[model samples]
Target chain A: MSTILIIEQVLNGLQFGVMLFLMAAGLTLIFGVMGLINLAHGSLYMVGAFAAAAVAGATGSFFLGLVAALAAAALAGAVIEMVVIRRLYAAPHLDQVLATFALILIFSEGTRWVFGSFPLFLDIPVGLAGPVTLPGGIEYPLYRLALIGIGLAVGLGLWALIERTRIGIQIRAGENDREMIAALGVDISKLYTLIFALGAALAGLAGALVGAIQSVQVGMGEPVLILAFVVIVIGGIGSIRGAFIGALLVGLTDTLGGVFLPELFKLFMETGAAQKSGSAIASMAIYILMGLVLVWRPTGLFGARG
Target chain B: MKRFLMAAAATALGASSAAADIKVGMITTLSGGGAGLGIDVRDGFMLAISQSGRDDIEVVIEDDQRKPDIAVQLSDKMIQSERVDVMTGIIWSNLAMAVVPAAVNQNVFYLSPNAGPSPLAGKGCHQNYFNVAWQNDNLHEAAGAHANGAGYSNTFILAPNYPAGTDALTGYKRFYEGELAGEVYTKLGQTDYAAELAQIRASGADSVFFFLPGGMGISFLKQYANSGIDLPVVGPAFSFDQGILQAVGDAALGVVNTSQWNKDIDNPTNAAFVESFQAEFGRLPSLYASQGFDTANLLISALEAADPSDADAFREALRAADFDSTRGDFAFGPNHHPVQTIYAREVIKEGDVFTNKIIGTALENHSDAYAADCKM
Candidate 1:
């Protein structure tokens, strides 16, 4: 209700939006370039966290763990692409979904088997663990602020990668005409592997960064993955720019909705009744936003028409 | 003709042996999000069975995959094909609600190791169902009492939007004789809590009580620490259990929770249990494991008190409160739930171990507040 509270909610929303963008950029890019609807993308995110945790625990250096996360995820992605995903490109979406879903099962079970059914701790490194004061006497986490920075930098880096590099051109070409790109003597398989690995690494980076603020456990990436999907879907599947905007929109909507809806409901109902109704409606707000977006622009805000 | 007669004789022997074997089926969230709690229950139950040396106890363990449909299917198979005499280990309430009714339909005793849904604690209670854990409402009630006793007025409550969360807030409100500043029902397994935390800070509640367990707990605690919301955070045992200890670590320090068991509880039985659990698991045992250990011990006591050769006899013995629990003196209530002490504890750093150390015992011989509401 207060201007200060509204500002704080918006900042909170932006931070969440940034995190979702980190997840969605890789996902949408992978989908756009590889033509793979990977259900196992979340598993790669898990891999990143596990890798980060293992390395960080071993090294006691969060920085090293982050690097390890990127390498591990990329390696895992490449290997999976070479062995499993390469075969699935020609397969139907259902088959791809099933195979990737199996990968999620295998990854989750395997992580549990290795880590032993318990969540691993990844800390916000010593200095970043504290809070930073914002405008209007509000305090925000230093690590989350760092994440917002990292997410923006990564987004910019991703945009540059796709728009400013030879590989980026090849990827865009592959997206536009895979057969044409292959006919032009480009090693499409290698390109696909590179894109997949890059996407995986990005996912892993997000996982490692987020894991510091959460638990690094099996299936940890799932809920975020769903949100990332929602982001990409709303942004237009394939558009990194759209992912950023869409993620922020969703983050703000979800965050502000949860807070304000209940207060709004309180105007007409008892406190408890207002909260129950408000929370229920707020929880659905993002999906509603997504639905409305779809109703208006079926392909998404930035999606290419077939 | 001789082969046929030999086959007939083996079939008769097999039938008799099958009748003698006590089939126990377990359905838990052995995979996905609920795996941490489910695995502890599974391990404790297995350890107890191993300790019992009861080779006749055949436990067919199945992962519910945290899906109700899968749980129903697995329970159905165990009931119809395996014909399990005693069934146990359902972690989630929905899974239990889905599977327990089916077990009750078959007249099989469903020993719930966790998740004592309120409905089962009341009107929907079946004679065949026994809950080893506290009624899902008991722990949160302790939290409410703790908050009230600690002078936390106008507290904001946050929980995942689910049956357990609903029950948890209800439990808190039952004991919390204070103005509720606000209550936010978040998405179950929400990774991000900054939005909610910001709102909580803005709402200016004196304290925030939450019921996020497992990974959600870790995220909430971490985010809360990050948000620098200096309010005293409180919740039930699962919010700061061993499963999330290392995950939350020092961030969880100063956070208060209420539970039925703490590893540091001074008791001979708990001492022995803790030592062995640490030795075996190489980590501290969670309350879920404690419930599982109690379930195992309770089952063993029932077996000892009953005619194991007769399934119906064993069920009656189990219902008759046959166990000396690890939680000192405890017994199953008429609705087949534990009426036990609930302790309020703070997450503390005990050298290398980051776990809850009991600071207060809120309810001594406290039955669930919801029990009176239940006619059954």
Candidate 2:
């Protein structure tokens, strides 16, 4: 590959990594603070995408649709937290998993009932519709570039929220010692709900942003959810910084692997066999990375707890 | 002893009366990501059955959830308990492979509305199996011919890494007379194409050929449109079908795709089917829907000649292939797979709706490559 091509692939990897970080950040925060295995988080992502598509179709404004996505997902997250998740905190992980798994089914069927089985249309904003010539004469999609900037900004914003704000301290403290925070006059339940909603909104934002490029349809979140879980595990559970780094690592590994693995194999094997074996291994590269990371550091790169 | 005699008599009477009724069990994906294709096939099949006004044709539909194991289980249930005389309404090739051979072996007529896997068309072909749809590779082969017609050389081709995916690339290369710039196999059910698109951009190919179906196609097309590579794209009709074209929006516009049937196929049955389907379902009929309609019609035509219980006579009737297909001049090859014309369609916008208009004939009177291998 040429230097220009490698640069372009790197940019693509960064874009994908940033997007994964959005989903992973929310999941890690929710798991870290609540200690509940929420399988329905992906459903919330789907909710955001569907809501954005609907509002955007109705209003013809991408910005308004994004706002709708955040509101709808947050509202859905808050309501779910109060009605279902509130009761699950004291429950075992298996019970939490089962309940949230049911939520995924309910949310999926409910969305299908409303939107029908066909995927919805959601395009990038007209201003970001085409590509831009970057430095070194590389032409890249402006929307993807914007996605990277937005993801990084969100990452910074989330970091500030967790580090600089009072709520951030309570969240961190709650992650450390929930009983102590509860005894210190903090309404842990309310904080849990707020954290869930905040995490949900981030997932929703990712959904809305990615939905513009990808098809906005039911079951869209499950794949991303799996990747996000991998991200948090690699970053260390409940660590936003870890999640960010892990997301980037997973993203870069996946993208670069898909492009280069086949070429690497081509050098040593027949063309057809190389493509087949290369792609077969590339699809598993992320899981291999995860396994290696766990072997090296079981808690993850940034995971504080065992 | 008296009660047992009476129950036996009642059972005999019920069996005699039920002999006239033809029970068809349809196991299709009605939920999950691939639901759209199955729904269209079901709707079209149901529409034809309803229009026939045959109350004796009892149709039992079940959702397979797009799982092969579930499909196998459903087929077993239909064959054993439901005692369905005819089985149909499978959408995916893998699911068809799981269900068709076994169902046909059980003496149940398996009329395929969609998904004609190559195995069933070749040495594994059964007398009771009939594929109303083109073989899985037919459209891809047509796409290859269309690419040649469009004068695209050094094409970059890609497909998901699976059995059917391998078949797609193999089919394309079988007919395409051009040098390939690159060949990549993407992960199945992959949503992102950023890496692949980057490769495409740098490949220096004059055109791109891909065979990703369903939402995978939508993602690829949208990402490709935005990537600004602007290379001409060609593919089978699965991606550009009526059910998916709306979601794909303007990104799909002006793209050439190949299919065996279109709404504008210039046949009386097709025109009426398209109109009534829109009237019934409030949307244009997809190619899957058309296949479903034709499948039902073929079954009805066979039923007119002989009862399904009479396997030999019914088989002969089906072999006659006398039916008004949505695609005109419909007939099965020796292997019971479709031998029909494949047309190249260009995606176009008519007002706000997205649909296909027939551009030209990609392959005339095309039959599958596997037909020669069929001993049956």
Candidate 3:
């Protein structure tokens, strides 16, 4: 491939990787600190998208809609954690799964009831609607580039929050020993709430950002949540750094595999057979990568052993 | 105590002497992913029946949840126990295929409001099964012919990896003479299209035709717009409709869709339907709703024309296609599928609603190409 096309593909990969990271970060955080598996994380994402769409429609301001998305997601996260999620922290994983699954059903149905079964569209703001030429002369969507930038900023901000802040220290302490931290007079319950809300905001932000590019509707978040789970598992569960790396790897692998696998197969097979086989294998590539990674590093590349 | 006994005796005598109501069992996807379509069918049929001033037909609705097995089981219950003379209402192709065969086997006349899958339209055409909707492939074929006429030489086809998807692509390719740049089949219920978008961007095709319905359509249109690819796009009506318009918004503004009905069809009947539908539902009626309304009218007309009590007579009357459909003068082909005009529609925003306006008709006096292939 030409250097220009190669550069463009790499950029495309980065964009995808960054988006995955946004989804993975909150998922990993919630799984790590809360010791609670939330299947409804995607529901929160859907909530954010709906909130953004609603607000954007009301005010005709995409920026305000985005802000509302983050706020709404965080608020929802807090409320859910306080009311329903609090009861599940000490519950069995099966119970957690069932309850969260129920939450998903309720959220989806409630959203449908309110929104009336049709998808709410979030328009790309006029400022970012046009295409921009990249360094390699690739005409990329400005909104997509903004998403990459947003994802990167969120990732870095999350890193700083976890590494440098006092809340970060408490979170780390809680992750290491929840009971001991409680004994040491830290508000462990409040910490959990804060972390959960923060994680939810990240998910919400991801949803809202993606919502501008996609339709905002019920059950829209579930597929992305599945992929995010896959991302975090590959990245090493409960590790922010791992999630970042894993998301990028997954994003790049998925994007490049989809495009190049068919071309690679064409070298040895007939065109039609090559295309079919290639596409099939490309979809399976990341799962295979995750499997191979598990074989090599059972705790993942950066996972903490219990 | 004597007075209460006398009143109870009189009420009991009145209840037992009342004529048995004609019960119709309507199985549809009333919940989960396919709920919207089923709801539209239910509401449209209810509206039509209500407007018709017919209280004789008592409809019992059941949710099949888009499962073929559930649909078949529901059909069995409706036919065997309830002994519903007529069975109707299915939105999904697989569900319709499953349930209709069972209904036919039971010697019950099946009136399909939507989902006229091709196999049933062809060799499997049972006299017992009648569809008020056009054959599934017919509209896509119109799109393909239109795309070919418009001089799209190198086209890319995308669809979910499923029966309906395969049927749609086959229909399009049957009429389209373009050199296919590529045909991509993504996983069913896939939400992310970034990878596919990248591939499409790289494929260098002049036009892209896809057959993603409902939620899939919304997701695909949104991602396609985000990818910054400027190729002309076309699909059947399901790709761009009232059910999905808000989800797609202005993204579908330039996309060309082919359909048997558009909201902007200038006819007195359609205009009246639209006005009343919007008044009641607070939204424009989707073509699915229109088909549902038409289905109701068709059944009523056929019932009026023949011996309503005879299932055989009702089936024959329905196949005769004697109803005045809002889509103008259209008759059912021998296979019990509508032989009607296919119009090319463009998605344009009017006020807050996204609606498909008829731009042109692809075929005038067009019968489905597959009709001759059906020896039934």
Candidate 4:
């Protein structure tokens, strides 16, 4: 590949990685603070995209749509936490999985009922509609570049929130010992609700931002949800730093593997067969990376718990 | 107790009307990512049956959920329990492969509204199976012919890696008569096209051909539009259909696509179908809907000739293909696949609506390559 193409691919990988961090951050935070496996995280992502699409279509304002997405997803997350998730805090992981899985179905069917089965239209805003030139004469989509910037800004803001605030201290304490934090002045239930809603808002924001480029449809979140899970597993289940690093690693591996694997196979195999086998391997590249990570460090690159 | 009583009464009604009744079980994706296509097909089929005002035709529709195993189970239930004499409404080729052969083997007449995989069109062809839609390769082959007509000598091709995807590339290459700059098989259901678009940009190709259907297509078109590659794009109609064109927005505008039917086809049946479809469903009919309409009309024509229980006569009646299709001239090849004209359609925005208009005929009197392999 040419230097320019490789540079472009790296940029694409970073863009993808940054988006994954947005998703993985929330998932890891919820698991860390709440000690609950929220399988309905993807549903929240869908809710955000749908909310954004609906508002954007009605008001013809992308900014207002994003605000609606955050509000709607956070509201849904808070409501779900209070109504359904609260009951399952002490339940087994299996029960939590079943309940959240049900939520995915409900959210999917509910979104389909409201939005209809057809994918809703959500485009990049007019100001960021086309590509822009970068250093060394590389042309990249302005919206995607903005996405990377926004994702990194969110990441930095999240770090500040967690590291420099009293709420952050309480959240970290909860991750360590929930009973101890509850024993203190903290109202643990309210804290849990806040954390869940916050995490959900992050997922929603990611959904709305990505929805501009991707499809805004039912079950859109599930695929990204899978990737987010892989990210958390590789980054360490409850570590934001780990999630960030893992997200970038997975994204780069996926994008680069997809581009190079087929070419690599073509050197040894026929063109068609090489393409097929290369794509097949590329699809499994992230999982294989996870496997290698686990083999090397079972706890993950940044995971604390065994 | 009320439910049980209702079931008994329905069974009694079914028994009483058994002589002249034709039961059709439609198994299709209705509740997931690919639900739009299935919903359109079901709407079109039901519309035709409703317009016919035939109480004798009992249609049982079930959502396949785009799962092959579920389709197989539904087909079994329809055959054994519901005792449906005819089956239709499968959208995907893999699902058709899962359900069609077994249904036809059990003597249930199969009328495919979409998804005519080459296996059923060739070596696996059965007397009871008929495809109202074009063969899976038909539109892609036509797209290739259109590309040649457009004078594209170097092209970049990509498709999701599956049987249908492989078939799409093969079909394009069969008539393309051009040097391929690059050919890539993308992961099925892949949403991102950044890597592929980069490859396309650097491939030095004059045009791009892709065959990502449903949501995948929506994602590809959106990303490709923003990628600044600006290469001309051509593909089969699945991406540019009425059900999805709105979601694609302006990114799909002026892009040429190939299909066996379009709303602008100059035919009385097509015009009426489009007008009434919008009136009934409050939306334009897609190509899948047209296929469903034609399938239902084909079944109606056969029912007019003879009962489906008489396998020989019903099969012949269906083979006669005497229904007025939305695509105008329509017939069945030796393999029971559609022999029809495939058109080149340009996506155009009328007001706020994104729809296709027929630009030219890509292929006339088109029959699938697999037809020659069918002995029957």
Best by DockQ: 4
Give lDDT tens digits, candidate 4, residues B75-123: 9999999999999999999999999989999999999999889999999
Q: Show model 4 residue runs off by greater than 4 Å.
A: B1-20
Q: Which residue runs does candidate 1 get wrong by more than 4 Å?
A: B1-20, B308-316, B373-376
Per-residue lDDT, model 4, residue B120, is 94
Among the candidates, what TM-score does chain A have in each? Answer: 0.97, 0.99, 0.97, 0.99
Q: Rate the local accuracy (lDDT) of all candidates.
A: 0.86, 0.93, 0.83, 0.93
Which rank order by TM-score, best down to worst? Answer: 4, 2, 1, 3
Cα lDDT of model 2 by residue, A104-127, tens digit: 999999999999999999988999
Residue-level lDDT of model 4, residues A269-290, one tens digit each, is 9998999999999999999999
Pairs of colliding residues, candidate 3: none
lDDT of 2 by residue, B1-98 (tens): 99999999999878755854889999998998899999999999999989988867989899999999999999999999989999999999999999
Error of 2 at B83 (Å): 0.7
Score candidate 3 by lDDT.
Answer: 0.83
- Please identify model 3 stretches exceeding 4 Å from their true place: A1-6, A266-277, B1-20, B69-73, B226-228, B307-309, B369-376
Candidate 3, B-chain TM? 0.94
What TM value does chain A in model 1 reach?
0.97
Candidate 1 lDDT score relative to the true structure = 0.86
